[model samples]
Target: MSNKVILVVLDGLNYQVARDCMGYLNGLIEQKKATLYPIQCELPSMSRPLYECILTGVPPVLSGIVNNQIVRLSNEESIFSLAKSQGKVTAAAAYHWVSELYNRAPYDAVRDRFTDDETLNIQHGRFYHWDHYPDEALFLDAESLRQQFNPDFLLIHPMNIDDAGHKHGLDSRQYRNSARAADIYLSNYISTWVDAGYQVMVTSDHGMNDDLSHGGILPEEREVPLFVIGDTFTHAETTVKQTELCGLCCQLLGLEHCKPYAPEMIAL
Candidate 1:
């Protein structure tokens, strides 16, 4: 595709929060020349399972990643491994447990375990913990990893918003504030990468309710946003609901041979 891609996941963030913070994100969207969508996440909508689905492009049934704390490994498949085989370098920066699940060669730079509070800051208008390992550290780490290994794909997960939402509620002022802060970081990150000529695909694994509870049968838990902006992709206002976002990623990367679960693939 001739474009490096970065996938940014804002944990537990909903459309409302993102829309409210659109002013911050819109600039990055314009700078990167990207598009936005409201994509659907899988049921239960927990972090580990949903992220696995996103990276592996397979559902829990096939990927064997059904929960947040468990690891499912089979000899035959892994998106990171497969991407490596295809000569694409892949890198990721995620919260503790999710990073462990995707430990593979091509996907480098997995962050060690950090508590939710340690990685996030809800006070002062919600910003990432820049004291220990700033957001720039992760971005620079990804950039360095890419420079050394030249990975074709990069995935980043920021957990402050999600953690705050879980502890407080999605409707809580804390959560919204966190979302706004996340938007600022995201915009800055996107601006930096897209300026470096990388296509940015921003999405989430799933959504959380106003009360910050998921893993249940609720539309709020399953609906998420999937937006793309880059030189390689087209821009359009389209909706892809209840569809597995993993498959969409595969399609965009021209790796559609990956097997996705039923109801995981939807057309916009």
Candidate 2:
């Protein structure tokens, strides 16, 4: 692969909230340094299902990882698997669910929390088991991984926004503050990644609702944002789907996509 990619999944960040509260990202949009695409996530709008969807380009129904409780290793070809197969390095500083989905099952907190085995789908990992794990710390962990391994594909999944949304509803101050805080944290590393030739894509798995719960069809629970950074995109108007992200990652990392995706979403 000739290019590298960094995919940031800010769990439970709503499109509208991100548009309003993420000042740093919106500023980049105004300056034409980034592009924002408001995307409606797949049905059910839950974290686990959409996480699988984003990485594998498969819908919940087809993947059989339809719910959060259906925890098992994924069977489909993910960006990590594809990159690794091509002898590219892969890493993630994400929630333990990601470790469970890609590296091992049942998440042995003792052994699976911090892994650096090349045989695993996520070759280098720093897995956190709880939602309360600080977002700033996760970013630091991600940066450490990048500096150490220079992974070809890196997945950074932070859960503070979702944790805030779950504890206090989407309408609450905590949820909004969490998004803003994440934006601030992102400001610390995005330019460095871009300078180092990483195509950065900041997005969310799903959204949250006023009742402090999700898994329904409400707009508040489905619509999320995708921020495309670096020099690979065009200004043309485009519509993107949640499942299309996996293909986009493959395209950025110079890999052949296994699933159908709109090539118009990115420019070569």
Model 1 bad stretches (over 4 Å):
28-32, 74-76, 104-140, 143-149, 241-244, 251-256, 259-268
Q: For candidate 1, write residues 1-268 as lDDT tens digits.
A: 5435677777777765676665666664666565567766775578767766676665655566677666543333445555555555566665544445544212233223321121211000111232234444555555555455454666677776777778777678877887777666666566667667676777777667766677765766776666666666656444554334544554545553554533322223
The best candidate in terms of TM-score: 2
Model 1, residue 159: distance off in Å is: 0.8
Model 1 is weakest, by summed lDDT over 10 consecutive residues, at: 118-127
lDDT of 2 by residue, 224-249 (tens): 99999988777457899999999989
Residue 51, candidate 1: alpha-carbon lDDT: 68
- TM-score of candidate 2 versus the correct structure, residues matched by position: 0.98
